[model samples]
Target chain A: MKAATTSETAEREARRNRIRLMQGNEACAEGALAAGCRFFAGYPITPSSEIGEYLALHLPRVGGNFIQMEDEIASMAAIIGASLAGVKSMTATSGPGFSLKQENLGFACIAEIPCVVVNVMRGGPSTGLPTGPSQGDFMQARWGTHGDHPIVVLAPYSVREVFTETIRAFNLSESFRTPVILLMDEVLAHMREKVILPEPAECPAVDRLRPTGPPEAYLPYASDRDVSPLAPFGSGYRFHVTGLYHDETGFPTGSPAKIRQQMERLMGKMERGAGQIQRFELTGAVSGGSDPVDTLVVAYGSTARAAKHAVGEARQSKRSVALFRPVTLWPFPEAAIRQVSGSVRRVVVPEMSLGQLAGEVQKCIPPKAELRRVNRVDGIPIAPEEILDAIVA
Target chain B: MANRIEVRFSGSGGQGIILSGVILAEAAAIYDNKNAVQSQSYGPEARGGASKAEVIISDGDIDYPKATNIDILLALTQVACDKYTPDLKEGGVLIVDSQEVLAIPEGNFRAYSIPIFRLAQEKVGKRIVANIIALGALVGLTGVVSRKALEEAVLSRVPRGTEDLNLTALRAGFEEAERLQRAEA
Candidate 1:
């Protein structure tokens, strides 16, 4: 590629600095492209179709590929295959499609493929409220696939965070050699907000670690480090990839000892590196100053937007309240919540699902810290007033 | 008072209701350098069903992306007007199509019944620009966004060949709004 002229560079800089309005789904696509995601395979689904639509138009322009797969199942499988071919790959889906992708999602999990799956959650169980907003998939993101497999799930509330977090999802997946789930609710998926996106140079992309030793000596599933380096298929390194329990050399193993070792290594990589994967926000009365927070609101995804507003409303009336939002939903920010719970008298967890997140918070906070849940299964975004009512109650 | 204003555009689907909200938000955020968030809620149907789109523009950060306290409500159809009128804030502004929305619900707000669709059809020579006319009327009545900004936003959004017609429709809406204010005076 020829280098850009000075005027072109200046114009590009000018465009980069402007604050543009972006929808949450558009941001996800842009973030994926910026993060060097060169391949996308997704089946169209409501609330998530826009991501694939945008990628379909722009991916080819950036020298990337976007394929409309036959179904959600094939979409998941194609991305895994593309990733194994040394491409940063992604796929997006919503509730019913998320369920469809789970069996393959579990395959990606056990095989430890580095891919990003964006689940723009709508009301669920089966095709329930396709256009409505719901965080019904909150728990499903954690254990949707039937296994004690490791996973990383990141939830973002605003369009700007959607862009940044999608990039982070790619990074975490690449670094950890595991699939990362970018969970977005319908409200956040469709909402448009003013966002000044960072240039590609500002947010550096992370590539999957590759085998450095001779191809003949490479073990596809073996590592002394926390994350084993993966060699791309047809990179002169030949190895088997399978969902079954395998030894270090990548052949299926029947030994209980090797099975235990494989499971331990897979789960242990995420457990030991949980701290680096966690991202959260603490605002309003976080410090132990004179105005210490007595009421704590823990929320994530679209619900956190309302909780943030409610926290502001509570503080206006001279109430001690703060908002603790976990951007990284899985590998729950337990230590931070426990520390904050020590200071607060009451803890409120608001989410779109009935006590999905609240149940998790209950386990983290102290028993004496009165836990209140403000939940909605009606497919409407939780209002700030509802959270405020919970705060004062 | 918080430096935030919530506006809602309600009409049947395929009437550019969501586009009106998006254009307003883009004008506020891109041209006016203000914070804006736009969201919409609609049924599965792509057309005919009542659709509502909301934009919250603020001098500060906008939390809670949806409209809670609507300062301005634009209803292009009677169904939309009936469904959403209850959410308008006290002393808010309600703009509706004069022909379609005949029976306005009583509220503690100012109501302007403009022939939005007729103006787009008769004056602008196109019925599809009714949403642009409504957008112009919206800005003219409230000044939620600057006129120049709205024009720029509209031009950027509409197709390349139809800028002139859309601009004429926008001006027609603005003139209609000015006429209403003059009549009140």
Candidate 2:
């Protein structure tokens, strides 16, 4: 018994040493494993393919299922099917594949299914640059699916953030009963960094909200605590779910009154719970406890890392500059941005796309506040020096 | 901050330039407690097309992970050198494998012509270990990293039994650097 106990302790220590240099996509796969994701279905696409490869190699070892579907459409459908069967499912793709998955994504939205989809963004329009980084998918993630539906999307700037936001994506999807997107660019997806992974004991796992009462009384779409609980298929709550408008019993309904109520409830949970889902980080914005003199740089994803560096350089030259990075892209941080408007004179928005987030910032900031955009759509990150020059000039 | 060295590895695909940058970044970040970031390009055509990896090491917090100006340039192909040479700061170091890179541009920066292929053939008897050989020579020339730390990093990175072969390649690179230093002195 003593020998067996000692061996167990040694095995635990060995597991702890799993910390090694890993690419961002690989770390994301490891994060999904820790998030209790049992089902991953994806198609092979540049940049985002590494995430699929990692899952294919490691998922079975941990008793999870990894499937490579025929294409993005089938991949997304399988994830939704797996999630409804009481499994935490996820799918990842790039710009072209993300475009193909939009129809199924709309299906998930209308069905109010819980799953996570990762878009490791690359240059776009149509397969522009498969390996290069781009943030052209910002507007697409928010408004890609048809109809008026609310969604949650998170952007991770570093490899470490990729790991954490993936877990958050699963948590939010399960809690809200909606498909959550974890948006990453090719730079963060391909770059290798030293990620300090959390110990198993430190990570919190969120399982699907199961029904508690008798199976006969269970209603899959019935509201409770502002969010409805999901009933597994074999659990006897054999309610029909469809892409068409549904009622409280999960059956298709054509009544305008029922349709209006269902849509409101579906959108209300994410809209009302925006405060809890939003996350951002600020640097150099509150220096010397006074109004920021001239420029405030707003960037996200890999571009935010460059913005932080530019802000630091500008400060060294006695220039008053700051950076505002949105960790959560959707449910746009209007309140936090309004706060920034009160303190800054000018806002400079730099992105890998041509003013996608800049347009969002313009809507949020005060009208009188000057808005300058440093836009690049060439599948490369905006350099730090470029932003610093803009700040200094 | 003043003593930190940032090196960039650039070459055509199949040259293992990304792995070389990774080894250096791991040596600096994990073994030396220095802040390091490694970025590379990936694509379907990366096997024979242009490929590059950039490593930035600093004593202070590295806010910008991308390298704008390189301190050392390891160009394995002419196209790689032509693309990146303009980005090297003045008086920077350039190391080229003699067999692959035929022309060395005249500049104030120090240039070393190491027989990386020949050394790989002689020591490890494999062209794939050419990156390990170049990395060894890089350690010898810069002395920014200690041999022991690099050896430990190499041992930890390679396959289970190939640790000794990599270590030998690293030592051969160190000797090549020492010999060059002695010749220059």
Candidate 3:
């Protein structure tokens, strides 16, 4: 009886901690905490400002620091600095702010710093819709910063997924020693839903691997393992880090040999780990374990939810359709699409932006496979019925 | 199984519509052992915008928390009345604070044009408690939630010193509901 009572009490406490009605931004903050993020720096931008506000209120309570930086550039810079100091750090911004942070984001990539940047996307070329939704930043998130570099980006559709993916973003960042972008659209940012927050013990926490042996023996960039160990400042391991090409000892090396080596390692880590980082969900890919789906719907972010609904509606009308939702938008899930392309006869890409993910889908699928694009950019989510019409047509 | 009630509150941004829905949901979920969901919608501009909150209370789990048809529609403004009146289920109740919401629709649904603002002014000496008055009328008309449960929920939610005033406002609403019921009978 005592054992049963104790177990029941534990279960009740767990349920109490879990059930919550949380906004998307609040879920992102909670996810950051669950992922063991200890530092957050950000500037206030509409739709994304609540993330900073939430972190400011909640971070300190959990022994984490939240700083409101002067601008997005400084905010991104501060998070990179915090990451180098051996703390998981993150920053949240919208389009204009994301544009400002791009240079530093590239710097983090070149320097191989593990950090997460959340872009709660709003409508924009420049301040398009401060409060409305837009998925226009899909290409920007991939190639926003100048130069050739690989990135890992994830888009979440719901509040609960926001919590889970923000945690995944931090894990991927640390594991790969690069920045991960949590690309959230404005619809997901402001949407409120019931989310069950995981208990402190239930969350998986990843700390950056630390250097062992004497400080004198440490070579900051020297690594046989795919992931190099990160040495925090003030640990008596003196090392130099710069945006310029560098040697193994961390000194500036302009030599072509050193530059080639550094670039390969930067690119290779993501390439090598691409299999692990690529995430997609395929619904209704097969029927009766033999017949393949003739119609395919490709979507990401907020549009994916509506696309899923469309796929359901299409299936009821005797149309064999399936949905491909890209959970991880970057290190673009090319392999998954290639696999899906083999079976499906026609592909439909619906997005809030003008054919961003559609371009990527076309790149992966064969030319013979019919590809269609359904794009909307009026700051409203694409209705399922519209996609259903496209599939049937 | 006990009867379930879903209420939707609509008003301008600063009118405490979300807070009223939250209080009602908490009353049902925390106090009455019912499953409840509260959802609110507001545009990007936080102020001077149409805002709404939907509260769903059920003995079982609520599958779709979004109100397809509302049981009670509390419209604090003319725009809200025009926008939400059609969404109220047939025979559902409509409560409007007559001072802020000047217009009303004639319909089959039980429409209560409560002098919520005047009652709030007379009892609490402030118009802000008009929502509280409407909430009281809702409780009296439906009896979906017990008075004690709502009173306790309000006390826990409001700030320390303001509990007494809110309680008084709630009791006044309950009294008004009793008077209306007596008159009808």
DockQ per candidate, 2 decimals: 0.95, 0.63, 0.23
> What value does the lDDT take at residue A364 in candidate 2?
82
Using lDDT as the measure, the top candidate is 1
Residue-level lDDT tens digits of model 3 in A1-393: 999999999999879667765678889998998898989999999888989898899899989999999999999999999999988999999999999999999999888899999998888899788877789999999999999887999998877889989998998998888899999987678655555676666658767788987898888787455677889988888888888878777788989988888778778888899988988888876523475878888998778877887887788777889888899999998988887777667899999899888898998887888998898888666777778888998
Cα lDDT, model 1, residue B74? 98
lDDT of 1 by residue, A100-142 (tens): 8899889889888999999999987899988999998989999
What candidate 3 gets wrong by more than 4 Å, as runs, is: A316-318, A366-372, B1-8, B21-46, B53-73, B84-95, B105-112, B135-156, B167-185
DockQ head-to-head 1 vs 2, winner:
1
lDDT digits (tens) for residues A77-141 of candidate 2: 99999999989999999999999999989888878789999999988988889889999999999
| Global lDDT of each candidate | 0.92, 0.85, 0.84
Question: How close to the true structure is residue A183 of candidate 1, measured as C-alpha lDDT?
Answer: 98
How well does each candidate superpose onto the true structure, as a TM-score? 0.97, 0.95, 0.86
Instruction: Evaluate residue A28 in candidate 2 and report its C-alpha lDDT on the 0 to 100 scale.
Output: 85
Tell me which residue pairs clash in candidate 3.
none
Worst lDDT 10-window in candidate 3 chain B: B60-69
Give the poorly placed runs of model 1, Cα more than 4 Å off.
A1-17, A287-289
